[model samples]
Target: MAGLSRPLETELTFPVRTYDIDFAGIVSNIVYVRWLEDLRVRMLERFYPIEPLLARGEGPLLARTEIEYLRPVRFGSTVRGIMWAAGHGRAVFDLQADFEVAGETVARARQRGVFVHYGRMQVMPLPKELRSQMESAPASSRQQGG
Candidate 1:
């Protein structure tokens, strides 16, 4: 698989477990959503740990997701999941992810998420420290060599 070169991309490899497969013997659609969530967490952990975010009573909450299923992934398939911050507004940002199996794209998803004040349950801007780090992070931080 080609290494992602996007300015804020993260890639992680996973194997399709038996439970991930559906009655059709292909990986279940819901499993991809879980994979995308994992990628999102990994991306956030790169710049800011969840502990600090929680300490500030902030939470990254998913607002919406749009996914397209291309090819079916079978059990035991090795998939490389890729995610990146496509864009952001004041309190909401867009994330894009691709699930590739054996060099073929199996699925793609776009997600919108918001930073919210946990207690207030209201949207909030991303942490300034995290925003700065994300904006100025080195290229190495963007691409993980597979």
Candidate 2:
């Protein structure tokens, strides 16, 4: 398993949309959660598309999430979300992310997850192929083409 894991990181940048703001005039707390979810999906797309995972009868499910909002993000501000896998053990894994605007981190988050067998809802071991990709991907390589 050691040969198949690493501190894999990636990021995505998007402008804050009108709907992302709350009545308080800043991006809503839930919007940051959505951004983190999107980041995870994009990471999967880069390393392991969902279609194949589903075909294998396995998929990841969130078991926990933790976030600390450092600053409010305003409408039209371009925020970059950086996500990375922090660690894993057998069927469970951990991920971390940060939301930044103009290089200043506005929020930081962590997620705990488990890969489950689709039909049985039983925890499954992390796949070696996925682990190999994670272990080999260069941290400096920002996922290209969105």
Candidate 3:
């Protein structure tokens, strides 16, 4: 979340739904988790389709999430979320994401997790195709934040 940031690879816009509002009349913190899920799915689809992963009984498992809320987001406001892959290890992968309103960041988050074989309940290496995509990309364009 602090070291580096890069161009967004998967960007999506969302309407701040009524149900997202808290008693304080602002978007609740829990809503950000939903948005993060959406962002992650989009990122996966862009680099590696979920269908293939699921077919192989492989899926990502989130181990942790850290969010920094920078500003209040109110209901009815439009939010633009940008997600990118930050780094990878033998099995763990890092993701960074930000929520923007009118070009200003309202929140940012970092997620660290790994892909696992569902039936075996074991960790799997980052998909080769997805890893190749990142390796073949220019540094500036490599999926950097999710």
Per-candidate clashes, comma-separated: 0, 0, 4
Global lDDT of model 2: 0.80
Instruction: Quote the positional error of residue 141 for candidate 3 in Å.
Output: 13
- Model 3 alpha-carbon drift over 4 Å, by segment: 1-8, 136-146
70 Cα displacement, candidate 3 (Å): 0.5
If both were scored by TM-score, which would come out higher, candidate 1 or candidate 2? 1
TM-score of each: 0.86, 0.84, 0.85
Which is the winner by lDDT between candidate 1 and candidate 2?
2
Candidate 1: stretches off by over 4 Å: 1-3, 133-146
The residue-level lDDT of candidate 2 at 22 comes to 93
What lDDT score goes with residue 140 in model 1?
Answer: 36
Ranking 1 against 3 by lDDT, winner: 3
Model 3 accuracy (lDDT, Cα): 0.81
**In model 3, where is the ten-residue run with the lowest total lDDT?**
136-145
Selected candidate, larger lDDT, 2 vs 3: 3
Name the top lDDT candidate: 3
Total clashes, candidate 3? Answer: 4
Tens digits of per-residue lDDT for model 2, 68-109: 999989998999888888766666767889888998999999
Residue 37 in candidate 1, Cα distance off native in Å: 1.1
* Winner on TM-score (2 vs 3): 3
